[model samples]
Target: MTKPSNFIWYELMTPDPDGAARFYGAVVGWTIPATRDPAAGDMDYRMIGRSDGGNAGGVLALNADMIAGGARPVWLGYLEVADVDAAVAAIAADGGAVQMPAFDLPVGRIAMVTDPQGAPFYIMAPVPPEGGGESDAFSVTEPQRVRWNELATSAPDAAIAFYKKHFGWGQDGEMPMGELGAYRFIQRGDVGLGAVMPLMDGYPAPVWSYYIGVYDIDRAHAAVRANGGTVTNEPMEIPGGEFAMNAIDPQGAPVGFVGPRTS
Candidate 1:
């Protein structure tokens, strides 16, 4: 529904939603409202906001029950597909695993799925709101939104092939990462969705990491350390003259930031 295999939304599941809201508010410059609507049926969920007042994503509070059921603190992105049941069937047949069965919500039907290499993400068949429009949750050149989605997996070639078949993603130009294999860029239509690269040794595991756009990299980096987040990779100049970095949030979830080096 969303342009065939586009990333529609992102969610951060953490033990401390309030603390995460505060940390991300300072770093990514998002305006997270303190009070959640009491009518969401006791779900501790908060919608993330961009500086332009658009919906960025959502934050879900992970409880003990979810933790015991194998849920951990992680930032997961939602990939929009056309058919939830058909996609789930294809994923299961192609070595991918389904974490959550397709379920209906106020927004759409969604299911949690993992790639063949064990990196987890979501698949959704969205039902557009009253006013029909595309989601602005992911933007390559926008601040305070998801700028990139990168996957680090043990099997890049296999993962690339599998995603291509199900999601219609194609491989674009790639960058050499030496022994870690190429940073194989993935594209959907004219937009560069993200890249698939060989997983590094020190990483927690094979995972999909998203980079959030910020106005200043230095200020965002400083806020990460100041707000109890640990920097796994320091801010460095990336392609296109912007800088990016990786860090573990206070609740131990990994996140990345991409932006200009202002002051």
Candidate 2:
């Protein structure tokens, strides 16, 4: 099983890549670089980064048919598995389902997969010559890029089982979430990979939400709303003293940025 601690790349797939790019650029303090994708019908792959020429991450408009076929606009986290084939096989044998088979790309072999209860994510084995390391985007802010991720799944047991069998992520602790009984936090060490919890009261099920690191939560939240995204949850301070704000991109994907609050 792959350790969830190995996650390095994050990607967002939406129908309106340009709009998504614009919204994130302002919220996360990244500049969208112009780079064309030959396979994407001439639509440029919008690259995000700091002004210092750091390579942040990517956003692409999914093919129209993918969206029409019941794919919801959402943020997807990609983990670097040691072996893509083994990971996909283990996912099926354990309980999860593979939405897309492992396919070769310039980076590596990747597959779209969902947990047993249908929370979607991607797994990949990076191509060797290119090697693997942290994204340059981390250079923009002191602790930039992704620092944490959480999946509020409807099926906690099945979600935990699937992830444990697939990624070797262990349960950290569980806390009561109002009427939802308990929400479980999973981790790959000290870093959070995501969580398995009941959907928030009145919230829809089976969506993966990513929490990105920023230098300032208040500024990030304000930028998100100013750039046309909606804030789902207002900025709040955690017991640890850090602050977070959850928002939705123009494509309606759940995203949030976190940073230390001023005293």
Candidate 3:
């Protein structure tokens, strides 16, 4: 068992699932495979496959009702838990709010939740795959896998406290961001997951953004632009000499990428 507090899965909710599939497939080198799960019923759900031949996430088509209710395309992360109901209860007690009540699908029991600062994410207790094992979609060292999870929040300290209390996350380190406050690194045990930082003034609402690993930054950046996506920032070097860029997919979902730079 990998314990109750790790990020185990990710998903994208978009109005145009087909367009999103094509855009992300080229930008991140993922293979979008049509989902055949009987549990999916009549809804259109697709899987995001990594370059190394494992599932990275899923693309969920936004229903008419969801869009009418003001739902926009966004990438959401799912944190694994042993008890979904218990976790939701704890979140409510800690001033957090529920976006979707807990429900069961063939894969797991999941609840959509937001932190006290209003950053949205999912809490799930997944069923083991048919062969009975967990998937390695959250690896930090694997290429084309989700490498980092970042939370941009209005209240960093309070957000950190909520995650720490529910998910057992701890402060590994911090980087001062001038007057913007500190970027606090969060980790589970020794594995560095990602960081929590203050949301910039002009950015959208508080949200969790994930960074996926790629083989080459320059090439990936090119693909991003060619596929109708928007790179919001110039590729910048990070702590490990890897380069990263923030971008919005063709359907307007924000995401990040990290990898080697091609000179």
Clashing pairs in 1: none
Estimate, for each residue in 1-263, the C-alpha lDDT of model 3 and write its tens digit. Answer: 24538888889898887788788778777887655345688878888877667899888888899899988889899999988999899898888999999999888999999999888899988997778766677877776688999999999888888888889888878999899999999998888999999999757789999998888889889999999999998799988899989999988888999899867
Cα displacement (angstroms), candidate 3, residue 237, comes to 0.2
**Residue 254 of candidate 3: its Cα lDDT?**
89
Candidate 1 regions off by >4 Å? 1-3
lDDT of 1 by residue, 238-257 (tens): 88999989999999899999
After superposition, which runs of candidate 3 have C-alpha atoms over 4 Å from their true positions? Answer: 1-4, 34-38, 130-133
**Candidate 2 error regions (>4 Å):** 2-5, 37-44, 129-143
TM-scores of all models?
0.96, 0.86, 0.95
Model 3, position 261: C-alpha lDDT score: 82
lDDT of 2 by residue, 17-99 (tens): 77776787777767665554555445446655655576556676677677788876777778778888988888887778889
Residue 27, model 3: Cα distance from true site in angstroms: 1.5
Instruction: For model 1, give the 10-residue run with minimal summed lDDT.
Output: 32-41
- Which lDDT values do the candidates have, in the order given? 0.89, 0.72, 0.86
After the best TM-score superposition of candidate 2, give how far the Cα of residue 74 lies from its true spot, in angstroms.
1.3
The Cα RMSD in angstroms, rounded to one decimal, for candidate 3 relative to the true structure is 1.8
